[model samples]
Target: MKSVTRSLRVLEAVAQHQPVTVGELTKLFGLPKSTVQRTLVTLAEAGWLRANRKDTTRWEIGARVLAVRPAALQGSSLFAAAREPMIRLRDQVNETIHLSVPDALHSMVVVDRVDCAHAVRTFHAIGDTSPLHATATGHAVLAHLAKSELDEFTAGTLKEYGEETITDPGELRAELRRVKDRGYAVNHNQYLQGVCAIAAPVLDGDGVPLAAVAASLPESRFASGLLPELGRMVTDTAAEITARHPR
Candidate 1:
């Protein structure tokens, strides 16, 4: 039990400060250097972290952690409900399609994705995380959260990833309101430079958000003229997923 507890602490530290060195983990945990080193070795052997080749003394999360997440997500009814619809949407718009769930307070994690055929396109694998403050999917999910949850979520710090990110709490609330009214959310080069996206919520039986769906493309291809047409396709796909999976 003690060993298990220590291992969890080490994992949390690595997750909080990844690509960190053993010496840094020791200082962060106030543990003996030897203990931190041993913990890091155990984590590496167990496929939780991998030492960096450029500097063997430093480590970052390994493939197993990412691989393990998608299996559980696939078992979810939401993922099952959203998969085919995502494929159809991707085919219709020929843009990168993403499906995410609000698994944490400040971000959503991608559980499934359909890559765009474009040679140059935005891409994120399953289990990748995106910040709530600066993404279209994040805004769509946030707009549909219960009022109490929304209040708690907004009370935290909002990171500004780009010039277009909505950092002020008041302004974020206003944006959420607009998103709710419009039935979808738009992110125009807000999270990443030259990337634009539109997203809509997949709702549960009570009409609260269960997940979100998005279509992303490079700003060079956004062609503002298509926003209205494409936005509806994205929302309609989300609505279809919501209807199939009410849980």
Candidate 2:
């Protein structure tokens, strides 16, 4: 059990200051070089740490660390909050419901989702990253960000996922402006062809965007004339979720 305790301590140390070398870990923990080396090797083999690609001499926490963290677990609660609402919305609109939150960087991570009962329902895996510009959820959240933050995100070149994906930053900015005014976002075959999504921001305790709630369906299922009603369903569902959040 002593080795296990030492291993956990080493993991905690690495997690706190990643990309650490053997010497740094030894110095930080006041352990011998051999002890730190053995512990690090064991932790790395267990999928807790990953050797840096650029500098193989150093190690950082692995993606598996994301699964064990408290924040990731807490994020799953967003699904719990949306379960009944999602079911209700899915039944009402006969569409799939997706719940997503911002990940470490530019991507929006899908935390939870429910698929429609139909065979042709839209399907997405949990923990998958969606493009911020091409997804309905992404637009809803980005539309609410501060100008400085939004500028920083859009400064880099964006990849074109589909023909309908917005490559022009200026046009995207205008679309975000429209989303801000309407309090909802729409993706018409922007990310995936044949699918359309409507999204709205789920606010935090202080009314900041915490996540986004979206309803996605095959274009064939919803007619163009029903766009306004579809937008309203997403916006109203997100509002219901925000009201449940404790301020």
Candidate 3:
């Protein structure tokens, strides 16, 4: 039980600061240097983190996390159907568009992304994870969860990551209700500062949300007045993708 707790703590620390050094992780976790070193070695052996190719002393997320992509995304029709829509969304708004799916850990993981052709745009790695309560992509899918799943997901403490992140489950539930009432979710400086995003879910045949399609951009580029049309565009694109591929 103690090792299990420590393992999760170590993984959380790595998530917070990737490409980090063993010495830094030791200080961050307040664990002995030897303990941290051994934990790193164990985790590396188990394919959680690996020595950075550029800097041997630093470690980054490893195959175990990244391997989720090939299995979670590649074999599915969702991945194939999502590509053109993702590209279309990127071209339509010239903003970063991402496809994210829920993970077992109450987080949304980016399965694919279409980058905007701009000097500055939102970017996230394929396997990067975001808390369901704070991210637009997360809310889009989470909003349609069954009551039991919603209860289990919201039972944990919600961490505030950005200025406007909703921490209260009641408040989150209300916002999710709005998401369900509508067909999309919006986040303004909730996941990251100076960034705004809108997302819509791609639902399966029975109306279960399979994933979320998001358009993310810098706050300056995300003109407040244009939100309605932007939200509609994403929802429409998501609907198109779902229609193209049903279980």
lDDT of 2 by residue, 1-247 (tens): 9999999889877865778899998889898999999988888888899899999999888877866654654566565577678778888887899888876347787777878888888888766678898999999999988888889888988789789999899989999999989989999889988988899999887666889999988878867788788889889899888876655
Q: State candidate 2's TM-score.
A: 0.71
* Candidate 3 off by > 4 Å: 1-17, 20-49, 53-55, 61-72
Model 2 error, position 23 (Å): 26
Model 1, span 114-214: residue lDDT tens: 99799999988666788987999999999988889889988988888888999999999999999999899999988999999999999988888878999
Pairs that collide in candidate 3 are none
Report the poorest 10 consecutive residues by lDDT, candidate 2.
Answer: 68-77
Tell me the RMSD of model 1 versus the true structure.
2.3
For each candidate, the alpha-carbon lDDT, in order, equals 0.88, 0.84, 0.88
What RMSD does each model have against the real structure?
Answer: 2.3, 8.0, 3.8
Candidate 1 lowest-lDDT run of ten: 10-19
Q: In angstroms, give how far residue 243 of model 3 lies from its true place.
A: 1.4
Per-candidate TM vs. native?
A: 0.88, 0.71, 0.79
Model 1, residue 112: distance off in Å is 1.5
Determine the backbone clash count of candidate 3: 0
